[model samples]
Target: MLTKLLITDDAAFMRMTLKRIVTSAGYDVVGEAANGQEAVDLYKELNPDIVTMDITMPTMDGIEALQEIKKTDPNAKVIMCSAMGQQAKIVEAIQHGALDFIVKPFDHSRIIEALKKASDR
Candidate 1:
């Protein structure tokens, strides 16, 4: 089965880019959210197999949303995405239960690889 995915990013362009990448890589783009709060809500509603989350967003940050999702479902598969130089935030996300992370601007191979790995887990 194609892995179901929920993509969360405040930027429309970022979300569109990721949606294209993941869908072309053969995963289903189940949902998209423009902010962390929306992400949290969609996650519950969609219960996608995995999530691609952005670190910086209005309403709530990725780390907070990650924590919220993990709180409701410990096995939630979340892969954080951030621009270069957000190592500290990435580490905190991992600590909060992110399955992995993808650094932006995204690499096509890396995004597919991360989704594959997260789906396998």
Candidate 2:
């Protein structure tokens, strides 16, 4: 089955870019969110197979959202996305139950690879 996805990013361009890449790669994008709080809300509503989450956002931030989602659904599949060198946050995300972390500016292969890994879990 094609994986369903929720994309959460504060930047409109990033969301659009990821949507395009994910769609082209054959995953169904079930929802989109502009912040961590929204991501959590949408995750509950959509319950997608995977989520791609940006580290920094207006309301909650990705780490917090990842924790919230994990709390609600221990098996939630989330992949953290950060800019080049947010190493500490990435590690925190993984420790907090994120399945994988991907560095941006968005690589198609990396996104797909992360999705595949998340789906496997």
Candidate 3:
């Protein structure tokens, strides 16, 4: 089965770019969210196979959302997205239950590889 993914990013362009990459790689995008809170909500509603979450967002941050999602589903699969130079947040995300981290400006190969790795875990 094609893995279902929920993409969360405050920037529309980032969401669009991720959607393009994930779809091209044969994953089904179940939903999109503009913030971490929405990501958490949609994660509960959609229960997607995977989630690509941006670290900085309005309402809540990705680490908090990742924690919330993990609380709800301990086996939840999440891969954090951050811009270059957010090492601290990336480490926090991994500790908070993110399976992997993807740096922006999005690279298709990196995204695909991350998804594959996260899905396998």
**Top of the candidates by lDDT:** 3
CA-only RMSD, every prediction: 0.6, 0.7, 0.6
Clash counts for all predictions: 0, 0, 0
Model 1 segments beyond 4 Å from truth? none
Off by over 4 Å in 2: none
Candidate 3 accuracy as lDDT: 0.95
Point out where model 3 deviates above 4 Å.
Answer: none
Query: Relative to the true structure, how large is the alpha-carbon lDDT of every model?
Result: 0.93, 0.93, 0.95
**Candidate 3 on 15-81: residue-level lDDT in tens?**
9999999999999999999999999999999999999999999999999999999999999999999
TM-score of 1: 0.98
TM-score on alpha carbons, each prediction: 0.98, 0.97, 0.98
lDDT of 1 by residue, 1-121 (tens): 8889999999999999999988888889989999999999999999999999999999999999999999889999999999999999999999899989999998999998898899889
